[model samples]
Target: MKLPLQALDPDLFARAQALLDDEWLAHDADLAPVLPTVLARGVGQDWHKAGTFRHHLIGVARSLALWQQPRAVRLLGLLHSVYGNAFVDLVKFDMATERGRLQALVGQGEEELVYLFCTASRREFTQKVLAGQIEPDGSLPLHTNQGEPITLAPDVVAAFLVVSMADTIEQWFSWQDDIYSRFPDTDTSRQQKVHWMASLWPGPMRPSGRMLHQINRLGLALQHPKLKGRLPMPPVFEACTAPFSASDDAAAASLYWSVIQQDQPLADLDVATGVLEQAVRLNPWVGEPQMVLAQLYLSAGRREDAARAAESALQAFCSWGNAWDKRVQWDAWIAWTRILLQGATTDGPGAWPERLDKLNNVALRAGA
Candidate 1:
């Protein structure tokens, strides 16, 4: 069995609904004006991961906004891949024909940033920058698909890196392990399937070592003493780059959480709970362990503990730069955690199947 279920508390539901409404309203406001243009370009109709391409685009923008990036950067993020890049060939807007139209929508400066992001060799740029290959003036050497060289000013390099970090965080998940399949890109031996279908299909699951490695590397670069004033370091970068070593425990916790998610024996719950508890202690800043611990507590009839764990999860998520699982956005995670809060505080028992159904439905709808 998974977590024990409980009826949602009515009062808690009202509070959650109000909070979510406000959050969504703010998010919508952040996307205004440019959002319409994005929709008109058929972004909403294009497929991406477990959701529409528009959803991914919006997610990237939201990440940038959460990091307190400027409006132009957020706009650049929203339209980052519209012209198609080396990674995906899904072109929502043709650069040759629609550049002027998009420039008019988000302004020339923001559109140019998007254009650069789509046309430049992002992976190569990232590698070079991380390797400290920047020019003396802090300019970045970039190349186009045709191997044409381009030079990015220091400010532009900073902005490009910020957007690149958000883009990775928005879409990377364990299910897409194939992206890191190159010889040295990832150590596949260190990765494990977080779900039954994780290796076979695309879905929400824990990120792999390859993903974390990329994130940490980017975080380190951004956190470097040199870039301090150049850009605002994303909160996730700070958390992940903190002077703490919880890698071993965190990896163990991930495996335990994965097993807990499966049709495992009941005897394994206690062991998994202990592992997760220790993992969170080592690094309370990480939300996944606390979220899983809340589930375990709820299953064991520890209502108060479950409530606290859920609250902690919410707090951690607030500062987290990306969704723990890429199948849904961070807002959806907030909604699910609120439900957990209600269930933990409520008194009546409920069917776990119903609760799981509700979550699944929300994820599907949100993805749509």
Candidate 2:
């Protein structure tokens, strides 16, 4: 049968099939009967903004199998959304309604993993796991469907990591296929997923070092070949490198203070511009430094540089999504900068006052 993902990206579909065949899942006696049922459940359901739920299930299972995870872990990945987990709600099959049949098919161990993956509260899990809120004895506090606290066993935690990584990496590739069109809100959802994956490090319930390393490598390997240099480096892996050592806000602030405190003239602007450039390189998602650079270029009479910086700021803002206050601020800055560039090109600096007045009006209206 033609998989839904085959129409979206033939290369990826082939890769998934290759992995499944290599793992012998394509011919597994236990999985053969269950696979059709799982696919049928997801026949018309969408998964994220990419392919159907069946595609996601198969993709995640293929990823886990390729990673050489235990059979139970791979099975968990295949059925992770059976009970409607936080991020996905396609199947909505209740364990209480069909636990015996599932357990009989995949065994109790794999069935339990599926139930855990499906029922765990994502918000609570992220808060507890990412925030270093585990108990002193090293158990991570996770909640069951009843909202009661339960400690995850070390092996279970490890399995969870494998499933989570497989699920996230699959989704990441799907998003990358047509990022803007798939996600109209921009890359905000993608960014959140990357951040969550990145934050898994230096924690009690963190995945093993080997698993983390594999995840980093897998993330790098999944990038769209054409978007290699156009998009920022995958945030999960980039966080491990040197140049991204300092946060963008911190780096930008340090540069701003150094230049402003010295009251440097426009001739010395190169020094400040170098720092701003580095800041953007470190974290292109943040727009503050780009906007600041645009203002500096405008003051220095570099119309082209100012316009480019402003455009970069606009792109960054759009990528960050539309939080109301930030959207207003970015819209004002973008409008003002574009108007300044247009006026400079048509009438030279002689029209500065009139352009400034127009910008002021825009700011006032945005603020209001």
Clash number by candidate, in order: 1, 0
Candidate with best TM-score = 1
Name the lDDT value of residue 354 in candidate 1.
39
Q: What is candidate 2's lDDT per residue for 208-316, written digit by digit as tens? A: 1122233433234323233233222322333213222224434544554455455445566777776666645644543456666766677678776666666555444
Runs in model 1 lying further than 4 Å from the true structure? 1-30, 135-137, 182-200, 203-206, 237-257, 263-265, 278-285, 301-305, 327-329, 342-368
Runs in model 2 lying further than 4 Å from the true structure: 1-17, 20-25, 28-30, 44-47, 135-138, 172-368
Per-residue lDDT of 83 in model 2? 78
Query: What is the Å distance of residue 281 in model 2 from its true position?
Result: 9.4
lDDT of each: 0.65, 0.50
Model 1 Cα lDDT, one tens digit per residue, 66-86: 666787777888888989998
> Per-residue lDDT for 261 in model 1?
69
